[model samples]
Target chain A: MTTTERRLRTAFEDAARTIEPGSLAPLTIPSRRRRGTWTVPVAVAAALAMVLVGATLIGDRMRGGPPPAQALAAGGPQHILAVRAGRAVVEDVTGHRLFEVPRAEGRYRAVAGTAREFFLAVQTTEDTYSFYRVTLGADGAPSRPRKLPGPLFRTQTGFGKPENLAASPDGSKLAVVGTVDGHAQVDVIDVRTGAHRIWRTPEGGAITSATWSQDNRTLGFLWGPKAADLRLLDTRGDGAELEDARVLRGSSIRSRAPGFGLINVFVFNPDGRTLTAQVQGTKTGDHDDTGYVLLPLSASTGEPAGRPVRLPSDSFFVKTDTTGRHLLQIIDGRPGRVEDGRFSWISRAADYDDAAW
Target chain B: MTLFREHQLSLTRTALMIVGDRATAEDVVQDAFAETHRRIGRLTDHDRMLPYVRAAVVNRCRTVLRRRALALRVGRVHEPPVWSAESAAMLGEDRREVFLALRRLPRRQREALVLRYYLDVDDAEIAEVMGISRSTVRSTIARALAALGRQLGENA
Candidate 1:
């Protein structure tokens, strides 16, 4: 080695010796605790139903006029399905609970939905997790929950720790990042047919999150623990080979410095040419240190077309509404609408884990 | 649990190199251990636990750095790394300049140098821990060394 290089290495080694890790406190492992199963009370369900109907009427009267003609033309006001305290509650943009899951059997981990359907990941047993799809009736009431056909996921690391699950905009397909046969696999299931296609990571790195493009033909997901890269897998082709999936070479959302940043949420714009991501900037502090940005990508090359437009900081969760016309974000536990490069709060006191507009 | 007992100290020291503070480094390692414990049942192979925990530590340290960056951007006062008298005496003046310059480098370059010199890991292992390609690791280490050489006024 060169003299200078050797000197540099010696200096680093000397500095590293100053840390005495043995003096740190020992790690404590809590006993394995089981989450209690939840069942919605019959009386509570009836009361909630009454309150929902009453709220609809009261909300209409508060508007000082009839419901918007466009809303009537489109059937009704769009609903946001949010899971709070193990119960999935459907609410409108004004934060009124429309209805809730009846006889909720398990703790709801994560939720994804469309105007017509709601998909929830519920832990039925200590280790068993399953997805349930509840169709919304014309009156905005949810139908009897039906278990979606797929391999059961484990709640070993909470509901959505190492793996993330997302449903297509139309609610026909569900994409999940989970383990299959001792490997980290991405499974795309045709919710109706119960048939699935799986893509396993060759290097054994875990897939953190998955989201379907608006067109429902492509699935975008984040891979790895540190310095996780945003990868795209084309689901249009037959699921015959792993080669069908390719990492977007230059589309890393964070700094290459491992663990400096993370892309928490990403979705394709309605046009399918642009991508919006809730990216945690490479800053060290609290969990709320992240931002939202818009990066236009080349449809053909999968590369970003231009520089990203940074939204507001601390906007951790983002999703587009059903019509894909408006962008919604959760900032400081409240819902906000993003328009004209600004975020305006929509609801006053809403604390939700996930919301689908 | 055994993995924590075996590698916790080494991991903390490695984190200390990246985060440049003993308390944050310890906190980072503790968080990583807690997370690893929570997800331990999902691990397919027990042998991979150390690497997994190591990567988690690095990622947690990055989170700390990220928060620090945001605080600085908003003009918030943050505590600088506290160097003990014993540490200062051991580091001396020339090594202290090098350490300060190391902290000033971009996160990626600093990580590359730490992994290459302090941990003495090769490109392949570094790539796995950093979640990058081996080719990227090679280039990153080379660039980092060149930058360090320039900062130290040494011919590369």
Candidate 2:
């Protein structure tokens, strides 16, 4: 490097070496993974069955009559993971967590919707099954676990794996997407009264993830082997509100997938009418160039109401604010851990490019 | 590793200068140390820790600055509406001159200068951290240097 370059570089180095610390205190208390300690013995088979029927019927009731469910044009928080002692603490937005649940523990059990609500969860360790009712406070911190009530599904232990945690908009029902033993299905649980309903998805397809809408009229899920497609369920309990759900298939995850998991960015616009998602591109470098699609909430079957609108963000889409005005996305190319707190905001239109810098 | 006893004050001062907020700067500095702690083994070469710490601070500054801008646009709801503590008391002329010059510059220019002159990041690494093409990173440094030269020149 030239003399001037060396001087400039050295100057920044000296200044950088002398930085103070962040004003906001970090989350430093080490928490133990003691979540799954609560389990009221429910016959495993019974719990599964109740979840199946309850999800179908309750979701139908909440659907408020077959409204076309929208898609998350720019997705919300993908995965809620907590690390205790360098291991992921199995927890959700609600206070409930399958603490100490192995990395991939738990059967097809229903839990609360997001970090916002609290509900029930079931985890199976080998032959033993543990159930807990997780309560979340207004502050979003999880409360102590209470054993789940009602008859558990009578089935072989560990039949299904927890896929997605989606709740009805009314906060009444939560859909736990998982496999029944080896069968792909969605288990529904009622929050206010502790009821269970489930729908056996014969497709046995893997549910990549799911998101609930603001209307509570629909639940959207992505299910597939490698390519993920969007599916909607009527949480209103009226019927399978599966009309107009579109699957943008074969999209490659081209960005740094940090804490977001290998998730397809599924975001429900704040207006609660539209859903947006990032379609992975073929060539994987940065998802910045990948396409996106937006689907509106209208109750017409066979394909989503609108075309998938393309977003111009260069990866790191966090969540959409309630107003739908600003889009939060992670800023790319940093030197910290993959999950380093780096993100930016852009207007739905004219938003992603220079604003990212 | 640059031992804390030797470099702590300098790191704190530089962070304060860039962020223009004491508490935030301290936090940034602490975070830089924590990040260093995590990567100490990966750094391989002990001398490289300084650059890594500098990069971390620049990135943190960008984060805090972006957060400030967002809070402002979001109607001051997320963060409490108040001037940062660093600017609360009146600073002497030299500090104020530096602060005002920084505040007047565009975000990228200030960051480029901070990384290039303050943090002492080489152009290539700065380019990587900032997510800009190297050429743009270089241009950003050039423009920032020219502006700083003029700003400091006027006072001289």
Candidate 3:
């Protein structure tokens, strides 16, 4: 080899020697064998029965006020999973706690769920966090908490204390936001394979919240403390590549002056074509008196697509259920269902920190 | 499994050169190993295992670089890979400068340089591993060497 080439190889080898081998967990080949074929028929029968019962209960719910407790005993999608008083509680539409975690960890910070499972983010240490995946049983009771891979360090995005983790609609991936080398990043983990992809915010700001699109290809996250705007990152690449990120600044949503407001909470609508955001802004001239408005935004452009729906009360957060049919607003620490352009009281104002359906 | 056990460390070192971070490099190697294991039954030629594993590792490294680039474009702060004090001391200033500058090169150029110089693969092998044409590999390596020379203040 030429002298210069020899030096380059030598330098690389020298650096390579410094890295300790087996620094990552050993790979375990997943078992491909299927187990328990007999249970399938019985499980299928039970699921069909539950669906019939759920449809009946939902029919009753649409007719009038909250359905009786017996109707909610079936434990369907109508129930809200919330973090209240350091506990993970599953409350019915009427705000009655149906199931609660037996041994609650540190206060539950944020939660997201699909039809089959609930993913909870809990603050375990002063600076570290943990995750729990709870599978829902037929009776609507959550099974024993199965801790997911975490002890992930936390990074505050100034958007409030909501744990910045979200699950995809299909529940195949969990996007958890954490700090790496002092920079905030979102790590999208494939739950089945344990394969993960990390996407660090280009601006280095803490991501306040993140939600995946219905297709799971687009990720919408709140970026700012400086240029507080909703940004959409296209995660469509060959397992390892990501398309260029698109910043959605609905022209109407930008503050007359820079840094006048922040898009606090955002979630893609069920249709995946648009989104809803809770915007907190100061009056143009008066920097004092802040107002919160629920604004509909174009999912493609991040611009205000419809008229701003002013919130009646000072709600701290907003979320949509997996079905995208129910919108829950947290006002005075209590969750109320929003329908027909109005907020209807569902659960009494309590010390609930986060909620998901 | 035996192939993995025998050459895992060497494969990891190769990945580390391309990725710059130990943890990420290890993950890349582990995934590549897992992938190689899954496809092991399809390999009719035993001699081709090492080449297959190398290509897998290199491709995984590219995936990581793509993610980093996406994050940077969206205004997310990227923390450059950290090097241990011992490694830094061993590398010294000139080697460290070269290493840092190497990472700054475009992904294709970086891979070409590492494969040619560190792995000591010929242009034909590099083209096969990189999934590019032989002429493309030649041009890429030439351009990479020119860039390196400019960064290092020496004819590479």
What lDDT does each candidate get?
Answer: 0.63, 0.44, 0.65
- lDDT tens digits by residue: candidate 1, A128-192: 77888887765568787888876776533234332267788778898876544334567778988
- Each model's TM-score? 0.53, 0.34, 0.49
**B40-63 in candidate 1: lDDT tens per residue?**
889898876766787888889889
On the 0 to 100 scale, the lDDT of residue A229 in model 1 is 55
RMSD of each: 17.2, 24.7, 24.4
Candidate 3 residue-wise lDDT, B41-136, digit = tens: 998988767677889999998888777766666778445453334446766765676686575455766888888887888977887788876645
Off by over 4 Å in 3: A1-76, A104-107, A149-163, A178-181, A201-203, A224-226, A236-244, A250-262, A284-288, A314-316, B1-156
Most TM-score-accurate candidate: 1
What is candidate 3's TM-score for chain B alone?
0.88
Report the C-alpha displacement of residue A270, candidate 3, in angstroms. Answer: 1.4
Instruction: Evaluate residue A187 in candidate 1 and report its C-alpha lDDT on the 0 to 100 scale.
Output: 72
TM-score of B-chain for each predicted structure, in order:
0.90, 0.67, 0.88
Q: Tens-digit lDDT track for model 2 on A147-180?
A: 5555543322121212245455555666665444
Report lDDT (Cα) of residue B110, candidate 3: 80
**Candidate scoring better on TM-score of 1 and 2:** 1
